[model samples]
Target: MKGLTDRQQEILDLIKSNLENNGLPPTRADIARTLGFKSPNAAEQHLRAIEKKGFISILAGASRGIILNTEEALGIPVIGLVAAGGPILAQENIEKRIPQAHNILSNKIDYYLRVKGDSMVDVGIYENDLIGVNKKNPIKVGSIVIARIGEEVTVKTLESISSNQVVLKAENSEYSNIEINPEKDEIVFEGTCVGLLRDFS
Candidate 1:
């Protein structure tokens, strides 16, 4: 209801109509066809933008996880294991959209990275834990970051950064710190960790 564009309001109305008529939310394809979008991806883009504006919450990992006007829950995308050299946020890598309550973490999370190794266990991150990440946050030394080394992605603490070199530190004693020379290696910072979620069940 704030500053939604005409098209956005149209989509929102469509969602409401679908829920009222069919007792379920419309799929991305449904929105695409109704809105004359070329593809479902375009619909998804608009949905995410609306979610950022706090109109709805998108539950990742579900075909229909859109919740209307959720004030207590925020839908955060869940990322599974990334393929080598693939974009970190590629749609295929998203396992599901899960709802995280607003008071769970202070930072505004962009996504949740599913942990795969014990290298960060000393800091409490373990295998299968979903770590919330904020891609917009400024990174500094000691911040735990999601980093891409060549095609591989890993979560480690930012030990240090120099003009020519950068160091990534592992929390576990068994793993050695990763040292890279920026001039020779390709490294990209995806995001910094904000909080974590682990399913004990």
Candidate 2:
């Protein structure tokens, strides 16, 4: 992670600042203009170096592909645990509830659920990120939600629901879709993911 010159550090700083302010990184053209580079190639070179050092990831062909390897600090509640399998801290399992600062959303968030797996990474909700959940049901079909199945709690996208079955989809295909029969099992929608907080350690 060393070997980055001062100019490269400045580029990294610019990217970080942009993410904090705009929720996304700047484009190559933006960097080139800000740094007084005559051509976008200069910005691209720095970006490649940063990516090589493993501090940032450059998404090929993406308009805004810069993603900081580490994120800024955000104060959020560290809930006990939500199982990726047959485990979710059922209401009865919660023994401690500490208030946390919400950097993304300020109102109506009931609790924060710390993500624990790669099941939702394709959508940029990585492991250890805190998702702001609201008990209020989302009025749309594609809402990302926190759901409870029996005793396990999982975060998934609500793909579709019917009188016969509820389909909970994972953004990452590695995790199979969760299909529940409303008649056979009790699948409860705890809350919708209103905000994403990627405050890394």
Candidate 3:
């Protein structure tokens, strides 16, 4: 009750309800979806605000790991500015945490990616928007993804031409499709974009 608004209080109650009935805390996605938020990042940001007010604690990188009491699991790791040539879930890259994210996803989100460029604007994804990612999701023919090549992390639609030949297509015609040769290129599929967040303010 220190500094939480009514909405935050509702969120805290929601977590408690989910934990009590389902034996786990509500995830950022659950919170966002239930609260009618367009993005899970809204829930994440609210949780951060609540955490700052000393209502909860996050155990970064594991699921259902919010330290509400002594009956929680590990947590979800929220990464900061991704380095050019680094693994996506590297410990050093984590900036914060989400307690857990369940419900409605076979492959749960591994992290939240802040969109950096306009290569996918034709698809309605904008620069500075937050994109939710599931690193383990299998890529499809027209999947929008966040990937890493050398020191650059890019978001694009994935198209596999063969077992080892892949093309990264941008939504904008100004940018050409990037052809990948795994034998010659150090390429890593970071994750698929599952959600997006942006600040109107």
Name the top lDDT candidate: 1
Which model is ahead, 1 or 2, in terms of TM-score? 1
Best by TM-score: 1
lDDT (tens digit, per residue) of candidate 2 on 28-49: 8899999999899899999999
* TM-scores of the models, in the order given: 0.66, 0.53, 0.60
Model 1 agreement with the true structure over 37-137: per-residue lDDT tens digits: 98999889989988887788899999889888842233577899897777988888989888755677899888899999899999999999999999999
**Residue lDDT tens for model 3, 8-101:** 8888888878877898888788999999999999998888888888778876887755656321234566665786565777778777776665
Model 2, residue 45: what's the lDDT? 95
Better of 1 and 2 by lDDT: 1
Q: State the lDDT at 7 in candidate 1.
A: 83
Model 2: residues >4 Å from true position, as ranges? 1-77, 82-107
Give the C-alpha miss distance for residue 35 in model 1, angstroms.
Answer: 26
Q: lDDT of model 1 at residue 36?
A: 91
Clashing pairs in 2: none
Candidate 3 collision pairs: 61-76, 61-77, 62-75, 62-76, 64-100, 65-74, 132-195
Candidate order (TM-score):
1, 3, 2
Residue pairs whose backbone atoms clash in candidate 1 = 59-97, 60-96, 60-97, 60-98, 61-96, 61-97
Task: For model 3, give the 10-residue run with minimal summed lDDT.
Answer: 65-74
